[model samples]
Target: MLLFNTAAADVFYKQPKTCPHCQSEHYSLTNHSKILRFTILPVIPLSISYQRQCDDCGYMTPVSWYALPTLEMLSIIKYFAGVLLLGYFLIQTVLGVHQQTTNEVSYINKPKLFDTYFVHADKFTDTPKRINNLKVAQLVEFDNDNMTFRVGNYTYKYNKDIEIAMRTSMLVQDNYFSSKTMTFRKEQIQQFYEDNSIYKIMRPELYSLFGGFVMHPPKPKPLYTGVKLDKHNQEGITYFKDGLYTEALNSFTLSAEGGYSWGQLNLGQMYRDGQGTQKSLEKAAYWLNKATQQGNLKAKIELAELCLSYDCSNLNTD
Candidate 1:
């Protein structure tokens, strides 16, 4: 159970409404809030839900749409909390954007040695055919008419991982840069800025942090639907491909809990391999059995192999 889930009684109604379970005329409305907190104090209201409890029978049911409270009728705590929480972040974001814009404008106009230019991967002549979206080009030489850059051999897909794009530690000796160099004409550089292809320009000092404002967005809560489960399974596969075993395990667990057969199979395999969590043959058998029950042929084969190594006679594979 979460630590800060709290429900508060809001209003009491003695109207001519009857409870479905028991014919009670008295009911109390309550608000259940999922809160975001700073230490012990509630900072923001993440979500709110309403329920109606019968006074006599103590039967609780979700409040009906027609009987729900209006926006004005709701508590002011949410609005007040939102203002306090968002105000600081808003100010920081604005300041950060201002600083970033000033740096970009300054760096672009005056070329300097080893100044980094964030550009589309396609701008590099020898970028891998895998369609890596973002690439860094460090300024090496420039004159009045043309500018040459030592393009990093690595290319990356543009995601939340902004810092990794400019990390010098990623550069290795031989494969760091190609023997050939890419040069852009002065007019082409101007065209790239006009077309928004040259996204960011910064010095080595700015590489430590990528975004203007420092913030870590929360991972979304998993939904228990077929589509959502499939997405989780796919995400798990991607994580596993990237050797992020812990993250892969988490995604697989969410998908498996939603009764996705592929997720169950993958989770069972991970258990067998001890990829993220400790190996447990019992847990492996349990998940593989679940997937097998759903007619997953791969899981059946894996379970057969697992049984050969472990004593499956007493284990509850079902």
Candidate 2:
């Protein structure tokens, strides 16, 4: 659109200069006549019986369409055609139009979803490490298979799988998490887990300010709150992924009733797919509607497509 408008402006600028005072063909129209060509495509193909002319002297003007139709007695049909073409493309955009169609829909997004993070690398997205009074938490090297890194004092132990999950997993991407440097200091990681590090680290404010660096008291699993826990939810996710339909259904059903959005999404998919649950589009739509009401954007998009597909305009999603 911008390019087209620029081309239109170019057309206007290339117009021949004409005098309106005297009834004389004063200006050099030869350059304009020879160099610039004008094309007006109107819907109805308006015929221009009279060319551009000076208002005062009634002398024929050399310029094409610069001074507006009202100023130059522009042919209505020609203007109408141009407007129709623009309107054809822009009407839906301006009018907030929607297409009602019943069809399965798929969505694709650009590949560059999340910023990449390399281990041992520091500084991710502006949050700086202020290691003023760095408190070291002596962590125990309990998990032999676990990988450890200590940024300043915070020691994180994870399998390479966990690191990969944090770095690239779609599940983590949906929930807001720190994208900044999650680098670790290995020795510090060992100390923090042992509780010896907690004893030694006296200052809390220091840890608070230098976040992502030191360890803190571990909190209870969020499982009880009904939200699906991360891999941290050891026993819960086991049967859920074993393809055991009953167990998976039970887990998701419990988790969904517990107010887990992921549970809702999966259970909705289950209904949508007719796995252990009865095949129910209505239930799919219902749970999707429920998830979206909880601020799930994916659910909203799905519901939008579903609504548009089924032509369910009478269904009040709100």
Q: Which candidate is the best by TM-score?
A: 1
lDDT agreement of model 1 with the native: 0.71
Q: Which ten residues in a row have the lowest lDDT in candidate 1?
A: 207-216
The most accurate candidate by lDDT is 1
Q: In order, what lDDT does every prediction score? A: 0.71, 0.43
Candidate 2, residues 1-318: lDDT per residue as tens digits? 221221121122223345655634442221112111124333332232224554445556444434334523343333455567677889866554322111101000111112121222122112243433222211122233332222222223433433343334322232223322233343443343243222211122322212322233356676566544633222336665676776777777776777766667667777777877788877777777777878878877877776665555555567
Q: What lDDT is reached at residue 214 by model 1?
A: 18
Please identify model 1 stretches exceeding 4 Å from their true place: 1-40, 43-79, 123-129, 158-162, 165-168, 206-318
Question: RMSD for each model, in Å, please?
Answer: 29.5, 26.6
TM-scores vs. true structure, each candidate: 0.40, 0.27
Q: Model 2 misses residue 172 by how many Å? A: 36
Q: Where is model 2 poorest over a 10-residue stretch in terms of lDDT?
A: 101-110
Going through the candidates in the order shown, the clash numbers are: 0, 22
Clashes of 1: 0
